[model samples]
Target: MTFEVFMQQLANGISIGSLYALLAIGYTMVYGILRLINFAHGDIFMMSAYFMVFGMVTFGLPWYVSAAIVIVAAVALGVLIEKAAYKSLRDAPRMSIMISAIGVSFLLENLATYLFTGVPKGFPDIDILTRAISFGNVSLSVATVVTPVVTIILLFVVLFITNKTKIGMAMRAVSKDFETARLMGININRVISTTFVIGSALAAVGAILWGSKYPSVIPLMGVMPGLKCFIAAVLGGIGNTTGAVLGGFILGMSEIMLVSFLPSLTGYRDAIAFIILIIVLIVKPTGLLGEKVTDKV
Candidate 1:
């Protein structure tokens, strides 16, 4: 490939990597707090994309306007889903809660398929995102630059919330010990809802950008990216936000490089993530930056 082609691919990888990072943060954050994989998270991302499409097609709104709506809707959905499905089983066995999450995920996906049908939908055109910026031999799409910028901003905001704010302190406390934190006067319900809100909001941003880049929307659009982001979360060490982003970038670059350098392996792209995941599980179960946990009886 030529220099320009290489630059474009790199740009593509970074853009997609940032989206993966955003989605991974949601997975890691929820797992950090509850040790539950919100299986519906992928569909939540898909719903957010659908919301953006609805905003444009139904209300004739601009992309940014729809984005704000998507963020709000995603947060609300996250909190509501937790209340309706997971709350009842919070005190149950971990396996039960995980199964409930899986059920919730399947429910949402089937509902989406029923409502939206099996056909794919195209993302509405937003001229601004299509524009390109060139610097020397390097060229970048507006969405490409926007993706990383948005991810950085949201990542910083998440970090600030988890580190500096009072709610952040509560989140950290709850993640460490829910009953203990509750005994100390922390509102577990509120904190959990807030955590879901933040995670879902990030998902909304990621879904919007992912849709814009791919310009395709389907009921199942989030499946692949969601799984990949999950890999990213685990790769960097689940519950570690910084690690999630690092892993996302690495995964993105590696996948792009694999396709670019070894054309024969393009068909195995999806399997690459799982292969890495299995390798990590076998060699380093705690992940690259994950902490090893020991239960005390």
Candidate 2:
């Protein structure tokens, strides 16, 4: 590929990577605290898209207003799902929580299909972000140029919240010793809910940027992306936030560049993520940055 071509592909990779990173953080955060993979996270992201369509098209709201409302709605949905499905199962076996997560995923999928009739809705064109722009030889959409920047800013904000704030301290304490944190007066439920709130909000932002780039809204749209982001979380160390981001960028870059370099392999883009996941599991099951956990007998 020529320099310009490579630059374009790189830019595209970064945009895609940032979206994966946002979603992957959700997986990492939940796993860090609960030791459970939230299979419903991607569905939550999917719901955010429908939320956007309803707010923007049905309600006839402005783009900014609709975006804000959708983010809030997504957060509420996350908390509700956690409380309704996972809360009671907190003390249950790990398998029980995992099964509930899967169940929630399917429920959202079918619920969306039943409500929306499996039609692919057009994501309303938010002119400011969706408009195409020319950056020298490589032309791209405004969202393409803006996604990574926004993701980086948000990542820093999340990092600060988790590392420096009181809630962050509570989260860390809970992750280290859940029983002890509760004993020390940390509200376990509150910390978990806050984690969900942050995760869901990031998913909302990711969905908006993703919709702007892909512009398709369907009940099952989140399946592939969601799974890929999970792979990214695992690849980087499922419980580590920064590791998740690193894995996302690497996954996105590799997938994009692989296809760009060898067009014939375009069909294997999805497989690439799985292959990486398999290698990571075999080589370092705890993930690159994940600590080995020893469960009590």
Best by TM-score: 2
| TM-score (all chains, Cα) for each model | 0.96, 0.98
Supply every candidate's count of residue pairs whose N, Cα or C atoms clash at under 3 angstroms. Answer: 0, 0
**What 10-residue stretch in candidate 1 is worst by lDDT?**
288-297
Name the regions of candidate 2 deviating beyond 4 angstroms: none
Task: Tell me how candidate 2 scores on lDDT.
Answer: 0.94
Q: Write the per-residue lDDT of candidate 2 for residues 53-164, one digit (tens) a residue.
A: 9988999999999999989999999999999999999999999999999999999999999999798999989999988888789888899899989988988998999899
For each candidate, what is the lDDT? 0.88, 0.94
Give lDDT tens digits, candidate 1, residues 1-297: 888888888888888888889999999999988888888899899999889889998799988898899899999999999999988888888889999988888888889999989788887777788688887988777889899888988889999999999999999998888778989999988888998999999999888888778888888888888899999999999988888887888788888877887889999988888888899899988788889865423
Q: Candidate 2 at 135: error in angstroms?
A: 2.2
Model 1 spans > 4 angstroms off: none
